[model samples]
Target: MFTNLLAFHSIFRWLVLAALFATCILFVYKHFTNKILSLKDYRFLQVVCLILNIQFILGVLLFSKSQLALLFWDNFQETVKLRQPRFFGLEHPSMMILGILLFNCFTFKIRNKINTKEAFTYFSKRFILILIIILSSIPWSFSPLTHRPNYRSLELTNF
Candidate 1:
């Protein structure tokens, strides 16, 4: 189950990135065009929220089941000394939660009856921040701090 969740987490990351990228692009276009956000735009934001929520849940589960997290809990000083364990156990989770919280700026952007320009400015800035946070912390295969495969198959490779 733990392995499966990890693989799923890896796979779902692509979906999360794609959704966020597309949403950010739309927000940027709207900002430059000075167009009032439409119902479709709002719905797309809702979808992005849904995707983020799902990814966050999966990440939480993986974090709970992770050996690195357990090790981090058991020996905070020791774990903090290493890079991979530290990345997976602490840096990744905290940064992701912060990014998710930053994503909630859109919630306010859509909910309040603020000026459309203000809304666009607020949301676009926070969304870009969220993107940067997530992109930075992600364990891409090329990352110098830590690295993981670009993809993980959800098959029972061990069994």
Candidate 2:
């Protein structure tokens, strides 16, 4: 059960990352190009936000039961500052939550603005800030302490 959950989370990160990047780019484009915020724009944000919310919920369930929580409880702030603990326990979850907040804020602020352009402009900048936060928080294997089990992409080799 744990392994299956781990695999699901590992693969799901890619989708979350892709959606995050797309939303970031769209926001940037809107800022630079002064594009109008159409229904499509809001729809895109909604889709990505929904995915992120799910990912976050999954992570919470996984971490709360695992040894990771034990470690986090023991070390708290110090654990979160380090690579492995930070990634799994703090960075990934906090940044994702922060991203959700940004999206919600944008939706709230822009849903009924009389000046669509100004509302969009506000949203774009807010989006960029969240993107930066998310980018910093992703857990790549590059970190030395990333010791989650069974991350191999194996294949049969011919001798």
Candidate 3:
């Protein structure tokens, strides 16, 4: 069950990433075009929230299984003492959560109002925030993200 869950988590990452990317683009375009918030906007936001929630659950399961909870302790050197464990246990989860939080902020802020200008201003800024989250969550060895998957497969792999 654990292995199956892990594989599901791995496979789901691609969908989450793609949805985020598309939503980011849509937000950016809406910002410039001053488009009205439509049902599609709500749907996109819902998808993002749903995926983040799933990832959070999967992460919790992974953490519960091993020493992951220990590595996330507030100490830096203690956390990075190892490689794979540190990346999977700490960096990836933390950054992903931060991204989710930022995305939520956008959704929460925009859901109440109907003013086109305000929506554009608010969501555009939120879109930028989401972009920042996406940028940070990317596991670029060149950047702060050190735990990114190198390749994506349609089917989950054991290796």
Candidate 4:
């Protein structure tokens, strides 16, 4: 079950990333090109918020069950001193929660139906900010510190 959660979390990241990029970059082509926000633009943002919300929930569950997190909690000071432990235990989760907050905040504003042009302007910038936060926090395989695979198999990382 833990391995299943790990795999799901790993695979789900792609969906989250793609949705983020589409909403912040691709779908907002109108805003970038000096056009107004279409109805679909609103939907795109909504979709990303939903995806991120679910992802955040999954992350919370995974974190609660993760051995690394347990070790970090039991050995706070020592674990924090190490790069990989610190990245996984503190940095990544915090940044991801921050991203979720930013995402929900923007979604709230849009759902309230503010001026279309102003909302588009706001969303484009806000979306980009959250995207950057999430992108930076992701532990890519190539990262020197706290790297993980593009996909997780049955075995979870011990580090």
Among the numbered candidates, top TM-score falls to 1
Clashes of 2: 0
Q: Model 4, stretches more than 4 Å misplaced?
A: 113-115, 154-159
Model-by-model lDDT, in order? 0.83, 0.71, 0.69, 0.81
Least well predicted 10-residue stretch by lDDT in candidate 4: 111-120
TM-score of model 2 vs. true structure: 0.74
Q: How far is candidate 2 from the true structure (C-alpha RMSD, Å)?
A: 5.3
Per-residue lDDT of candidate 2, residues 1-159 (tens digit) = 565566677778778888988877886787798777777777787788788778877787788766766687689967767666656666667776887677766776676753367767677677778877766665556645554442533232421
Candidates in order, TM-scores: namely 0.91, 0.74, 0.72, 0.88
* Model 1, position 13: C-alpha lDDT score: 95
Alpha-carbon shift of residue 22 in model 2 (angstroms)? 2.1
Candidate 1 clash total?
A: 0
Stretches of candidate 3 above 4 Å error? 67-79, 138-159
- Please list all clashing residue pairs in model 1, or write none if there are none: none
Ranking by TM-score: 1, 4, 2, 3
Q: What TM-score does candidate 1 get on C-alpha atoms?
A: 0.91
Candidate 1 error regions (>4 Å): 156-159
Ranking by lDDT: 1, 4, 2, 3
Give the true-structure RMSD of model 4: 3.6
lDDT score of model 2? 0.71
lDDT of 3: 0.69
| Candidate 3, residue 17: lDDT | 76
